[model samples]
Target: MSKANTAQFFESVKAHGFVRRSAVYRWMWTNYDDLSELLKEARPSWIVIARELNGIGLRDARGRDLASDNIRRVWLRVSRDLEKERQAARAQQRPAEPATSAREEPKRFNPSRLPANYRPDVEIKPQPSVPATSGPYQVPASIDVSEVPEFYTRKDGTVVHRTQEQRERIAQQRAGFEKETRHIDRYILTQKAK
Candidate 1:
């Protein structure tokens, strides 16, 4: 509690590499009763071991053990005070009032802000098909190539006889088809905008 003892305690904290100042409060709680003047003069050694090194546990940080105890004490004190106030208020009671103001009218929504073209009736286009090559069946015009069946494989286990160069050419064609469709989609969007 004295200045010299406080300084000595701080020195001990420093020696222990407890650089954080708030941890000194924890140190005080642990060493609650060793109020010796002799502890002041020594260049007090660092805390070698602590039950907690530093950092609040789930149980007791923020002086919560102390704070919770204080809170309970204050809460009891407040409840007692409130009970006294309530009794006093009851003793000095006045009569209740009758209803005074007129009731509020129900609100109506503004109609003009709603869209005139809002329609529950909607047209849904059919989803496009996936392009399949190397099949006897003709591929549909709207087929999505990414979902296309592998061109090299058939149900029969016979691999298609396209060369590596031909395979690369087909891949390039597929890529070009996808690229052209993206441009076509943009054109469709621009026409729709107009």
Candidate 2:
């Protein structure tokens, strides 16, 4: 089944990024006629129009309700197109009358504003709150590794440990380790000649 036809959607979603705008244009282009009909019906309301779009699974790219402005833009375009169609039919069927003034020009239909306090009949359930328990981690008092000061050597033969004497011995034990480094680093390189 098409998402637009069956998926549950939010009222006016805030679409950002390319994906959302693409969805909007896709919905607009695909459902153009349906949207126009919704605008033309008696007792046209923006909220109702938005709801109809929602029914078709239209929403902000983020899956949230679309903003009113975005919905209004589409609504305005549909309503304007409808008006143009009506005017064209009138012009074609009825012969030309007196030269029309600017006021007579076919203007965009102004649908009544939705009631200020009006809200959708959606059941808004309170979001589940995470328990206020301590996070899944503990702050240790210190990272003191007092046991033996274990060490590891890097690929470049550099030794890392809690003491200089241990690092020196570890460095000498390796075949490719540099002796001069031990001298400069005061690691007792004298005893390990070659």
Candidate 3:
């Protein structure tokens, strides 16, 4: 339909208060052309259209009196349906075309066209292979490392070692930790008793 006819049809839909998804909408679809012509001849407001619809025993899909909002929503839905129908018709009228050329062939790898820096005379050398061990490994009897130092010297020539006082403090902390762990174990076994 042309823009003018579409506008007329929408106006008629608004003026007639056709309910969406109801028997009235189906009826309107069937008599669209006649309604368009009638709308063009007489442009009525929503209130007048509602009164006429009520007089003719016409109501909305929910059996209630049609309001302006309901009529506007119906018009919107009808317009969308019309646009979709027009688009579908246009698509059907056009012919489909292929996207790619039928004469083109797939490309293959060409090694002869190597980079300028590539030298075919240079031979590639094989790397040395180490034997693979499969079973669980056995530990060495002993690892001798007497030459290894117990403490490392700093850049200022001072050895980093624990003092006598620090060693005594660490031993006391370890003893206290062991005592606390034993007490916790006993408490747990006795159901948290002191």
Task: Report the alpha-carbon TM-score of model 1 versus the true structure.
Answer: 0.17
- Lowest-scoring 10 consecutive residues by lDDT in candidate 3? 136-145
Clashing pairs for predicted structure model 1, backbone only:
129-143
Q: Per-residue alpha-carbon lDDT of model 2 for 1-194, expressed as tens digits?
A: 57774433432232322343446666665577775665577757667767766777878767877666777786566557657978999889997677876668686645466576777779999996644523322212243333434644456754445455556677777734566566666755554663
Winner on lDDT (1 vs 3): 3
lDDT of 3 by residue, 62-175 (tens): 798877666556655666776798899999998865676686687775777878777678689998764453422311224222333444445785443335336768999999
What is the per-residue lDDT of model 1 for residues 86-113, given as tens digits with 9 covering 90 to 100? 7889867955445653565656766676
TM-score of candidate 2 versus the correct structure, residues matched by position: 0.27
The better candidate by lDDT, 1 or 2, is 2
TM-score of each: 0.17, 0.27, 0.36
The clash number for model 1 is 1
* Top candidate (TM-score): 3
Name the top lDDT candidate: 3
Superposed model 3: Cα runs more than 4 Å off: 1-20, 97-194
lDDT of 2 at 58: 79
